[model samples]
Target: MSELTTVARPYARAAFELAVENNNIKAWSEMLSFAAEVVTNPTVEVILSSTKTAQELADLLINICDDKLDKRGQNLINLMAENGRLSVLPRVVELYADLVTEHNQEIDVIVVSAYALAKKQKEELSRSLEKRLARKVNLNCSIDKSLISGMVITAGDLVIDSTASGQLNRLSDTLQS
Candidate 1:
């Protein structure tokens, strides 16, 4: 993980917990999405990294955001600005979303195969994976022709690799070893 990830971790966790406790995950997600976008803008990026005073940066942020950020959102941004870690907002938003979904007993899976999967096939795979993992599964799919055949499924820390390309690499490694 990078320094940005490290700095964003605690803020993400705190925001996620607040969202869950208040049963306002959607609202929090929306707020964070806006913050993430604003924080990545060129002007915001300059404000975050420049040697400007903390108050100056915070005012710039508030003025830029105008009506977009709520009190809670501004508070979080202020805290980050005070710490000179505003650049971490994007990472914080991403991790906050991950935490929110995890708290909701949902898992995101990335499926890689040699070809595009049909809608029926995707639905079936998602349902099967949900049953297998005992959680709601959100899926992202991609075609990787280099895989030759079979598919690779990634969910969180777990990965199931059954692609021909993976097998060939494994065979090569074994033979070399």
Candidate 2:
């Protein structure tokens, strides 16, 4: 996993720089996402991992992607194919998304609650998180009955756990200590 990420970082950074220069971050993001999906298809994965020549693999991928990828994007795919790095495309997409979020000065936050949140509640939570994180917050809400009650807010490395299960665990730890 770490090896893939290490190999993918340079490619993702190059793509990010190109996107920034072209002012086409959104387009590049969509293109990379589509390309990643294509590369991950079962047939495509088999082909990629087979004994085909680099050019053959590159052509197959480019043809599969077709009009969704621009010339530079195609070039990226070709380069990765030539280097036997096509399998790292998914990691590149993940790193690219992180770059895009940072460039846009936005952060993604996940809220796991026992039940659905009202629209008003979501808005309030977003507002509160934005104030705390000092960045525009994009909230992704999910339901987890195991939480029992309340919610867990996760913004990157910071986790604010308010769920009943979480509280009980903390109490248990205190008692144990």
Candidate 3:
């Protein structure tokens, strides 16, 4: 995992820089995401790991990608294929998304609640988080019944555990200590 990330960082940074220069961050993000998804398909994985020529592998990906990738995107694909780094597509997409969020002064936040949150509740939570994090908040909300009640809000490395189960665990730990 760490090795893949280490190998992917430079490629991701290069892609990000090119996107910034072209003012096409969103386009690059979409392209990388699509490419990542494509690579995850079992058939595509086999072809990628096969003894096919780099050009053949790149051509297959580029064809499947269609117009989602422009010239620069195609070049990126070709470069990765030629260098035998195509396996890092998923990590590249992840890092690219992180760069985009950082560039846009936004954060992707996950909120796991005991039940569905009302639209108003989501709005309030977004507002509160934006104020606290000092960045535009992009919320991805889901329900986790195991939480019992309340929610767990996660943004990058910060996790706020306000769920009943979380509280109980904390209390148990404290008592044990």
Clashes of each: 0, 0, 0
Model 3: CA > 4 A from native: none
C-alpha root-mean-square deviation, each candidate: 1.7, 1.4, 1.9
* Model 3: worst 10 consecutive residues (lDDT sum): 22-31
Name model 1 segments beyond 4 Å from true: 172-177
User: Which residue runs of candidate 2 sit more than 4 Å off their true CA positions?
Assistant: none
Which ranking of candidates, highest TM-score first?
Answer: 2, 1, 3
> In TM-score terms, which candidate is top?
2
Report the Cα lDDT for candidate 2.
0.94
Give the TM-score of each candidate: 0.91, 0.93, 0.88
lDDT of 3 by residue, 135-158 (tens): 999999999888889999999999
Writing each residue's lDDT as its tens digit, candidate 1 over 18-137 gives 877888888888888887888899877866787898778877887777787778878887887888877788899889988978888999999999989999999999999999999999
Pick the winner on TM-score between candidates 1 and 3: 1
Clashing residue pairs in candidate 2, if any?
Answer: none
lDDT of 3 at 119: 97
